[model samples]
Target: MEAARLAPEDVLPASEGITPAWPGRSVAVDGANIHVRDTPGRSATVEPAVYVHGLGGSSLNWTDLAGLLADYLDGQAIDLPGFGRSDPARSYTVTAFADRVIRWIEHSDRGPVHLFGNSLGGAVAVCVAGTRPELLRSLTLVSPAMPFLDPRRSFHGRLLPLLLIPRADWLAARRLAAIDPADLARMVIESCFADPSRFPEQRFAEAVEEARLRYTVPEYTSAYVRTLRSLILSFVRAYLPGSASLWQVARRISTPTLVIGGQRDMLVDVRVAAQVARTIPDSRLLTLHDVGHVAQMEAPRMVARAVLGMLSEASSVKLVPRTGASERPKRARRNTKSKRDIPFGGGITPAGEAAG
Candidate 1:
């Protein structure tokens, strides 16, 4: 028997008066909490931009990019359901993640704004575009984890499969906490950055601190476990050879898209970067050399450019690339003339380059 199919409207309920407007606060939706941070652009006409972080990551991951893009329009970022300062969701799935995003879209003061996501967040963005095209102006994905287990060119991510077991969570959680600061720091330096030398010491400290804080939470173990289970199940279902893959949804996405990845991404193979571009009819790819899994961290300007480009395209605006993208004004009134661009590329462009 087939699993189930959900309509766009069925998944996204109208969340009127449900989610509050908070620049850097938590909001409730569908009984689940999500962290939201909004920055108004310089212009009243430009639409708002929504940013989503990956698994175990919060809206904080997008802080640098969000601040720059928010300057482009009414800008924003989210913690998804479970990972950040906000409380975990009652249920979790790619569809559920999409639902939270859609409901937020329905509730926003800005209509059909630009949507940006990274890794897991990238997958959610794709699902939202496929499931509810009407709610999106464009899509910008940063090293989205849409590809299945590529036995070659990947290792640490193999850790995800072990997630099928509950015990693994305990061990992983324990290990995360018990590891020496120097060793943990080494992992961060190796896994997170293309140039470990450049990372600000305080910033890395905050990430480690946040990870430590999560380790102390009671639900942290279970939430991480269930989150892993969901991924394993989704992966199994999406990769049944003859069945649909995440790329299947990408193909049906009518919205314009920009897909990007880092040359040094170890978790999700950068090879899948072009898959999104090939599958999404109107998509592009930007692969930055010497970067890692966290594009927003390693290259915020590049991520911002892709998002702002897509937003401009969706709003039908003729944009001046590079520097102008940084100038997006705050939320005001919609201008009939131009919009922000949606640029998620599959190949490496400079930090903020636009393609034809």
Candidate 2:
């Protein structure tokens, strides 16, 4: 679980005002322009990992974690359609998003990849693994947006209650557009972090500026609304022909999987992580106490260590057995150490002890 020592040249400063430190370049995927963070210097033998961000998040979200793993993994993070610099597609369905990722992987001709996703992206990764397991070598999900009835834990859960009326999205967009960017940024940080202080000041300022820029885009609000609607629809589409419930899809996945959850996560309930781990037959769960919704952003070193640890043991990592309805996942012992390298199996033990 040691953090990779990123060299001075390997690290890029946070971009002026808007962009985060991650390096991005536009590339077409599934006939749509995709802005991706393509980190350099991966060994030829190591399998590349593709990162997918959550709703409203761009590939820039993966910057710190991607850099930490760059030595061991050829990492690239995608700005899903309608997010980041990518143009919104006509359809923003979860399946459509998953298909684009699958197509991109296929186009790379790099064979199966180690896929990592956060929140909404995690759910999308599950779709990809269930439908096209052949394209993935492994799967890592951080607080995936699994179906939950609790409004406190899900955007759809809350949105559904208000969207029974027509044009709800249109109305929601107008309200969202009225929010000041700086206020919106602070709100996001409050919602996502267990301790807002964990985020660096420079990055926070950049994020606020980025939020301001996003608010000014003519298509951003509509894109946000459309994507949010699609996300909600995916959870209830089990009745659709050829569609499967997230639980059902989880059962169909054979790829090695890692599920990470933050105990204090406000968005995706941490208790749900155990169910997700149990449902995905070949999966392991790591629950970090006191961490929030965005563990990668709030606890990048721990995430980097867990992911690298998972990759290092890709062939031998054993899956935890499905727990009973009341059984809970093991919680890791919290650590208070600052950013530094630890051993390969640093944070998590073979017995599911979570490192703080």
Query: What TM-score does structure 2 among the candidates reach?
Result: 0.80
> Which digits, one per residue and each the tens of the lDDT, describe model 1 over residues 2-39?
11111122111111111112357777765666678776
lDDT of each: 0.65, 0.71
Question: For model 2, how does the per-residue alpha-carbon lDDT over 256-281 read when each residue is reduced to its tens digit?
Answer: 88888888888786777777887887
Per-residue lDDT value at 353 in model 1: 44
Number of backbone collisions per candidate: 34, 7
Supply the global lDDT for candidate 2: 0.71
| Model 1: lDDT to the true structure | 0.65
- Top candidate, metric lDDT: 2
Task: Count clashing pairs, candidate 1.
Answer: 34
Clashes of 2: 7
